[model samples]
Target: MSFGIFQVPPPANEPVKSYAPGSPEKQALKAAIADMRSRTVDIPMYIGGEKIYTDKKHRLAPPHDHRHTLGYFSVGDKGHVEQAINAALGAKEMWAAMPWEHRAAIFLKAADLIAGPYRAKLNAATMLGQSKNVFQAEIDSACEIIDFLRFNVHFMQEIYRQQVASAPGIWNRLEHRPLEGFIFAVTPFNFTAIAGNLPTAPAMMGNTIVWKPAFTQIYSANVLMEVFREAGVPDGVINLIYVDGPEAGEVVFKHPDFAGLHFTGSTGVFRHLWQTIGNNLPIYKSYPRIVGETGGKDFVVAHKSADAKAVATALVRGAFEYQGQKCSAASRAYIPSNLWEEVKNYMIADLESMRMGGTEDFRNFINAVIDEKAFDKIAGYIEQAKKDAGVELVWGGNCDKSVGYFIQPTILKVEDNQYRTMVEEIFGPVLTVYVYQPELFEEVLELTDQTSPYALTGSIFAQDRYAIELASRKLQNAAGNFYINDKPTGAVVGQQPFGGARASGTNDKAGAIYNLLRWVSTRTIKETFVPPTDYRYPFMAEE
Candidate 1:
C-alpha cells in the first residue's frame, strides 16, 4: 500500500500552555521557548525536482507528553522511495562532475543557514518529534548538524587538494573519483545528526544521494532538506523519501543504480541486507559499498577505587540520555563487590532527583520514550525482570502513555550475568547492575564479552593507573569506543571516530576522515608523452 493512502489524524490532546513567566522552570526552558518563538514550517516530501504534499498526514507529537502535537508531516511510501532513487540516479552524472569547490560552497552555505535561521526550529522539531529533552535535542539536532556540515565541507576540500607522491622516475598520478552511481542513505530516528550525515557525506564527495529517513522523524528530516535546497543544492542532487524499512530496503537493495548503502539501525537488518546483497552479487551491475552502524549493548565497569558519585552520574546520564534510545546507551554496568553498596546508593539518589516530565518543562531531566510500541517493549522487559529470580527492582516500573509513550527511569540489580536482563539491550531508561570481585576483573570482562552478540561501546573506571591501563588494553577489541573515566555516548566528531565492530557495526566512524573516504572511489590517471612511435621495444632496438 502507498503512504498517500494512509491518513493519520491529529493528536487527541490539546496544546500545552506556556509556562509561568519568571518561574525557574521557565528559565530552564530557554531552548524550548526560543524554539517556540521560531516559525513553524510545513514539511513536504522532496522528489524529482518537486516538493510534493500528500493527502496522508502524520502528526509530530512530543514524546515527553503526547498531548502536544508539534506539527503534521507528509508521508511517502514505496512509490515515493522509487521515485527518489530514480531522481538521484538521474542527477548522478551532473552532480558528480560538478567542481569540488562549488559543491563544498553549497554545503558550507547550508551549514550557515542551519546555524542561523533553522537552528531553533530544528531543535524544537527534534524535541517534539523524537522526544529529546530541550538541551539534548538542541545539541544533537541543531548544533551537531551544523558541526557535521561544516566539518564535511572542510574534509571535502582537503580530499580534493590532496595529491599523490611522484616516484623518482615515473610520470604518473592518482586521482580520487566519485562513485559510478547514486548512494542510498537509510538513517535512524535516535539522533537528528544522523539524518544529515547520510546525505551530506556522499553529496560532499560529488555523489548524488537517495535518502530514506525514518518515518517517526520525517518532519525534522524534511526541514533538513529544505535547508539544503535553500543553500543551493541543485535539484535532484539529494532526494528525500519517507517509507517503511522493508519496502525501501527491497527497492534499494535490488536496484541497479544502488552504488552504496549507508545504514544505522538494528543488527538483524544489517545482516539481512548483507546477505541479500551477497545473493544479488551475480546479477548486480557493480559491487556496491555497504557501511552500517548497528546494535550495541554498551557497558560501564566501575572498580572499587572509582569515585562512586561520579560513576553513578555518568551511568545515569549515559543510560537515560534521549531516554536511552541511542545505540551507544549504557545498558549494563559492572561494579566491584566491595563498592556495590556505595555505587547503588549514589545511583538511586541521582535517579530519584531526575525530574520526569515533558521537554516543555525546562526542569524536567528525563523525557518519554518515542511511541506506544517503545513504551510497551520497555515495560515488558521491566515486568519480566521483576519476577525473575534474585532480581531487585531498584527503581521505576511506572508508565503513563496518555499523552505520549512515557516510561519511568528504571534500574535493576541482577544477581548474576546469567539473567536475561543483564545481557539484553533494553533500549530504555533501564539499567542492570552486576557485582563482581575485583581480582576477577578479567573473568568479568570475559563474561561481558559473551553476554551480547553486540560489541559496540564500553567503559572502565578505576583510580589505579596500572589497573586502568591493563583493562583498557584488554577491552580494546571489545568496544568500538572505550571510555577511561567518562560515558561512551558523547563521542566528539574529530578526535574519536565513532562506530562498533563485529555485530555492533562495520566500525565506520561517522565524523572521521575514514568515513568520508568510503563515499569516494580512487582512479589512476596516466598519460604517455610519445604515443609509442615505434612498436619495437628497447631490447629489440639494441639487437
Candidate 2:
C-alpha cells in the first residue's frame, strides 16, 4: 500500500535525559514509580493477540524490596509456546507481504512513543522491576531501546537499497525476503532494551516472532508490549509468552517452521540450545539462523603511561554500574604495578563515597542484583575468593540479603592471572585485578587475551601512542568492541555495533545492517529483454 518510493529519514540517537535535581523528567518518573508501587497488577501472556491467563502465576517483586509484591505474571507451558508459534506462522504471510514503508512506520512510531508519552512509565518500570538506578534506567530502558527501534528502521532501509550490478540488456533485481518461518527471541533480564530489541529487530524485517523474556524482566517487558501494540504492530505479528526455558525450547526447536533464534544470555544455555536445534535440524523446514550475544569476561588493561585517575574512573564506572551484569562490563583488569597505588586509592575513595539502596532513591548509585539466585551466586564467588589463597578481597566485600538481594561492589586483587574470578563470567558487581610488572606490557597483553575464552569487550588505557597502538594490534582479536583510553562498556546503537565472538556468542553487530541481514533470505531475479536463440552457446562454441 505504499504508493510512493518511500525514504525513511535518517535517524539521530535519542538524547539521554538526565533526571537532574528538580527536573520534569525526574519528577514524572518518581510519580510514576509511586503510582506503580501503590497497586498490584496481574500480567497475562500475550499470545495470538489475546491476553491469556493461567492457573500458574509467578510473583513479581523488586529485587531491592522483595517483600512488596508489585504484580504476578501468568506462567505458561509447552502449550503456550505452541500457540505463540502457531500465531506467528498464522500472521507470517500478511506481515511479510506488507509494504516496507508501513513496516518501517510502525517501529518508528514505536520509537517516538517511547521517547514521548511512554518514557517516564517505562523508565520507572525498569528501575523498579530490574533494580536499575534512575540513570541506568534512563540510558537502557528509555534511550537505548528508542535508539534500537529507530536506528533499526533506518538500517532496514539501507539493507533494501543494496543490489548487485546487472549486465547490459539484463535487468537484475535482488529481493531481501523474510525467513520462511518465525524467529524465537530469548532475551535476558539485564537490559530492558535487549528484551525489546531481540524480538522487534527480526519482526522489523518482516519476520514474525515468539519472544520470551526472562522472568525477572517481565514487569518492564509488559510495558514494551503495550508500546508495540499501540505502535500498530498487528495482532500475532509478535507473540509474547512466559514459560520455562526447557518447555519453550522443547516445543520451538522441534517445530518444522522454526526458522531463526535471536538470543542474549549465558554461554552454557546458548550452547545447550544450539545443540538442541542441531539435533532437531531434520524436523525444521529450513536451516535455522542462530544469532546470539552471550557471556563476557571483559577486560581492562593499563600501560605504565596510562593516567591513573582515568583508569580508576573507568574501572569504577564500568565494573560497578548495574552491578556489572552487562555483557560488556569490565570484569577483569591487567594493571601495571607502576601506577597500582594511585589507581587503588582512587577506586577505594570512589567506593567509599557511594551509597546502595532501592532504585526509588536517586541517591543510591548501586542497587540490588536481579534476584535471590543471582545474590547467592555472586556471594558464592565472593566467598570462594575469600577462601582462595591466590586472591585477596581488597574493597567492598559486604553481602546482605536479609531485606533485598544486595552485594557490595566487590574487588579482588589477584596474584594469579588465571584466577577463577578473573577468567569466569561472574555477571555481577565483581571486578578482579592482576598487577603485572610495567615492562612486561606485551606479555600482559598476551596473558589478557589468552586467560579468557571470551572476546567480547575490552579496554586499553595508555597515554603513550606506541603502547596504545601495540596493545590495539596485539589484542585485536581480544575484544569485538575494543576501547582505547576509555571503559569497554556503553556501546551505543548507531556508533558502536555491539556483539562478540568465540564463547561470547556470534559477533552479529546487533544495531547494524548485518544483524538485520540475518532475518532475510535474498532472492536474485534476472530478466532479459530478448530471448536467446540458443542456450548459452558462446562458451561451448568457443571451446
lDDT of each: 0.79, 0.94
Candidate 2 lDDT, 1-543, residue by residue in tens:
666867897899989888889999999999999999998989999987799999999999999999999999999999899999999999999999999899999999999999999999999999999999999999999989999998999999889988999888899999999999999999999999999999999999999999999999999999999999999999999899999999899899989999999999999999999999999999999999999999999999999999999999999999999999899999999999999999999999999999999999999999999999999999999998898898888898899998899999999999988889988999999999999999999999999889999999999999899999999999999899999999999999999999999999899998888999999999999999886886676667753
lDDT of 1 by residue, 1-543 (tens): 123322212112111224357754335446554565354445778887898788888776666656665567677777888888888888888887776777877877887786666766676677767878766876687667766777776676667666666554445666678787788888888899888988889888988888888877786787788788899998888888766778887787788777888899888888998899888877567798899999988999887788888788888889988889989999899988888888788878888888887776667788888887888999999888878889999888787888778788888888878788677777888888888888888888777777778889998888988878877877877899999899878875665678999889889888777788888888876665546567888787653
Question: Which portions of model 2 miss their true places by more than 4 Å?
Answer: 534-543
Candidate 2 has which clashing residue pairs, if any? none
Counting clashing residue pairs in each candidate, in order, gives 2, 0
For candidate 1, the TM-score is 0.91
Task: Show where candidate 1 strays beyond 4 Å.
Answer: 1-42, 168-170, 530-543
Cα RMSD, each candidate: 8.0, 1.4
